[model samples]
Target: MNQERFKTLQIRLSGLSNWLITLAVIGILISIGLGWLVKGILILIVVIVITPILLILGVQWWLKRNLIQDKCPVCSQEFPAFNTTQFQCPNCGEPLKVEAGHFSRLTPPGTIDVQAVDVSVQQLED
Candidate 1:
């Protein structure tokens, strides 16, 4: 288990480094392409302006698709599950939080009588 985890970490680090290098190479290529073409505005625009933006976008795509680890919503720690509500965060014991659902209602009517929060938070009157 420890070896597997170590390998996973190593792979993640390697991927990050690779993406950074790719950005650098794209930058160099853009500069060279601009110098070679010398198409004035178009050259500057395509190589100087567009390539870096594309590099940034590509890095984002790669990280989102390949690298980001799933995190526990409550404790904000990386864990294995893809969805929230699988279990309480093991580290913090807080129930896993989930994104708001469509028309999500906090409490069903008639389930509990909610009094003013300023009042005692004891169980609602039956």
Candidate 2:
């Protein structure tokens, strides 16, 4: 399968797992309220055991999909770009914008230049 399709599948699976877990928890609660303490405990135990595994797998998939190698435009240094559009280059401290899997330097704001001049005043005699 292509990378994009695989990533999309991973996201969908993660959401499905979350919904399943929610339903399981609700079932456990209902079982306990209905006086099936042992059944509820077993289901709770199963959920507790499975949740961490699903969470770890989901996080691994997300990190792999979101973190990408990118080169800084100013310094040409390569770094991992997380899920963000704007970031600063670590090597040269330049602000950068990410678009279409490419990095570009951001334009700095314009500033007005000011100059100081000294003036001499003549005193008027009455």
Highest TM-score among the candidates is held by which one? Answer: 2
lDDT of 2 by residue, 1-126 (tens): 589999999988998999999779767877778547656777999999999999999999999877778898767899988755788898899888877667877775694435669899899999
TM-score of each candidate structure, all chains considered together: 0.25, 0.53
With a 3 Å backbone cut-off (N, CA, C), the pairs that clash in candidate 2 are: none
Maximum-lDDT candidate: 2
lDDT of each: 0.58, 0.82
Q: In model 1, where do residues sit more than 4 Å from their true spots?
A: 1-41, 71-126
Q: Write the per-residue lDDT of candidate 1 for residues 1-126, one digit (tens) a residue.
A: 689999989989997998999778767867877434434645677788788889999988865554324555444666543323334555766554334321112334586645556665577787
**Model 1 lDDT, full chain set:** 0.58
Tell me which residue pairs clash in candidate 1: none
Over 4 Å off in model 2, which ranges?
1-35, 108-126
